[model samples]
Target: MSLELANYEAQAREAVKMFWGNREAALAKQVASGNQDAGTRGAVTAGKNMDGFLALAQSLVSANGLAMADIHVQRRVLTLPGFFRPTKLWDMLVIYRGQLVAALEFKSQVGPSFGNNFNNRSEEAIGTAHDLWTAYREGAFGEDSARPFLGWVMLVEDCPASRSAVRDTEPHFPVFPEFKGASYSTRYDLLCKKLVQEGLYTSAAFLSSPRTAAGDGAYTHLSELTSLKTFVTDFSAHIAAVAAR
Candidate 1:
């Protein structure tokens, strides 16, 4: 039987539109209250910018035969045990039949400050995956349990700064060839691809959209490997396989 993808392409475009639209709304709300956060923090702190993607994920689980799965999105119920830390909170968690079906992280980055934020995001992604896998290996979820689908989805603002070549200082040694002259978007593409290649996440997606995307819901996938289509297809397949079992 074919995997059910839940019409994710259209949902993803709508999600992209919501992402930008929500950010703008959040920023405006804060400014109206005379409590605007510095830089893009206002949009982020207001939260729910990625709820559209969350809805898509929920739909995929239901369409693929996990309608009864406990999809946790609330902060109080999102904590999972960690190896290095006592607990880690995920953006979403799927549990079914007393087993963890999946855990996913949804993140976004916007500029005037891509350089530092990129490094921070990279470190956080790597560390989070390592921590989760180590905890899983230690039976954090349950004994003799199948590995759950772990996914990461990142949305970045597409603009001149993020798309331009980033120069790095090579004081001691050269950086990796692939990263030497890559733009932020290219770097995120590499990050997502490598996360899957190293078995850190079952699938990772990289998407970019301009501020203007709020009007028409336009977005771009940096590469086929990290595209939203690939992410949703893999996720839907995993959900179907879990249901089969």
Candidate 2:
């Protein structure tokens, strides 16, 4: 791996460790003390433990030497106007030279409830991209010469619940053949691939790390297209070319 990418890999482990830390802290704080809404469990169940994704984003932007002023990770600052919806909050946003440079979303799913959350995650991902593209086509960001870079990074827990076959029931008609007997991991892989294939995203990374070993950034990647290495490489190349000009 390139030096910059090597650094990202090392730092990815930090994200994993931070994820666990945040989870444990939230639970501990609520249990030890008397706090009801302290932990991250929610109706939507997104952004439960985001430290790892944030770290991943920080490493990427810093590696590219992006100015701190040009980046926004806060919810208020990251919200952008949309065509389908009024506005949507993004995980990370970068604007430079009066143009939207990039927008990224990070999502993760833990085990024991993969079946319930799979479709929700997919719909959210697709709808978010569709809304952004339509908004961009309608000049939501501005009259930039080119489209902004859109990225997605998903971290999935490596557990039996997520890896086992997910039963699919098609009541009226048949579903996609590839989806047959697919697990949560496989579904995510397909989702990332389709997002890029449809031009909904510039690149997408589907990463998996075990709860036990993710602290050291230990994970497995089987898909070449959606690998974190591929995502980082592609993202770095885009940043490099844009910054050079």
- Which tens-of-lDDT digit does each residue in 1-245 have in candidate 2? 34666777776777777666666566666656665452346312324586566666656765775644387787779899899889999999878777787889988877668876888988999999999999999888877646788999988889888789877888999889989998889999999999999988999989887878634657777599998888888877776666766
- Residue 232 Cα positional deviation in candidate 1, in Å, after optimal superposition: 0.3
lDDT scores for all predictions? Answer: 0.93, 0.78
Clashes of 2: 0
Error of 2 at 148 (Å): 0.8
lDDT of 1 by residue, 2-99 (tens): 33374677888899999999999999999999999987799999999999999999999999889999999999999999999999999999999999
Q: In model 1, which runs have C-alpha deviations exceeding 4 angstroms?
A: 1-6
Cα lDDT for residue 40, model 2? 46
Question: Can you give the lDDT of residue 92 in candidate 1?
Answer: 100
Estimate candidate 2's alpha-carbon lDDT, on a 0 to 1 scale. Answer: 0.78
